[model samples]
Target: MIEWFTIVQVSVAVAAGLLCVVLGLAGRKPSDLTMGAAALVEVLLIAQLVIAIASPAFGNEPTGSLLEFYIYLVSAVLLPVAGGFWALIERSRWSTVVLGAVCLAVAVMVYRMNVIWFVQGA
Candidate 1:
């Protein structure tokens, strides 16, 4: 994993998460803005997935367990998807908060994945 790209992913996730959380706390229901933020996080995760799959070909291999890295990557990709679906079905402010929480969780998970890839066993 490229360090710069990982930083970008984490930054976006944090910004999106904070935005959604603030909106929800302001009594706003799930709206396009909130949904779009969640979607953006999801998109980044998808890009990370693609990068992870392709990076090894370019001689960028993880220093830690490959299985563990894939597990973290795949799960990080799922959080926004599940949160967005729940928000769509529930249509509540709390669901927006949940989406925000999911983004935050994804950020932490991505950081851990970064550590697993580049820090551990280095």
Candidate 2:
């Protein structure tokens, strides 16, 4: 994955998480803005996945551990999508909590992705 893109994803996730926290604390449900940000993060993740697949920067063939890569790839994108949908349906402050939880998850996933890449390089 591109370093800049990873950095951007991390930044966005942190921002989204902070927004979610503030909204939740204020008793406001998650807004469209939060959902939009989550969607944008998913898009960035998809781009990162494409870069990983295309470059496989660790130098091993991309196909050898396809399943492992795919698990992270799929979940990283799917979690926010699911969270956003659930948030829309809930229509309560809990929705903001859900969004915050998703942001936390995305942050963890990004870190894990970096770790996997680093370990593979060793």
Best by lDDT: 1
Estimated TM-score for each candidate: 0.97, 0.83
Question: Model 2 Cα displacement at 102 (Å)?
Answer: 0.2
Model 2 ranges with Cα > 4 A deviation: 57-66, 120-122
Residue ranges of candidate 1 with Cα displaced over 4 Å:
none
Best by TM-score: 1
Backbone clashes in model 2, listed as residue pairs: none
lDDT of 1 by residue, 45-122 (tens): 899999999999999999998899999999999899999999999988899899899999999999999999998984
Each candidate: how many clashes? 0, 0
lDDT of 1 at 65: 89
**Alpha-carbon lDDT, every model:** 0.93, 0.76
Give a tens-digit lDDT track for model 2, residues 10-122. 88888887788778878987787778777877888888778887765556354234566668877988988888889888889988888887887887787667656544542
Q: Which 10 consecutive positions of candidate 1 have the poorest summed lDDT?
A: 113-122
**Model 2, TM vs. native:** 0.83
The per-residue C-alpha lDDT of model 1 at residue 61 equals: 91
Scored against the true structure, residue 51 in model 2 reaches a CA lDDT of 81
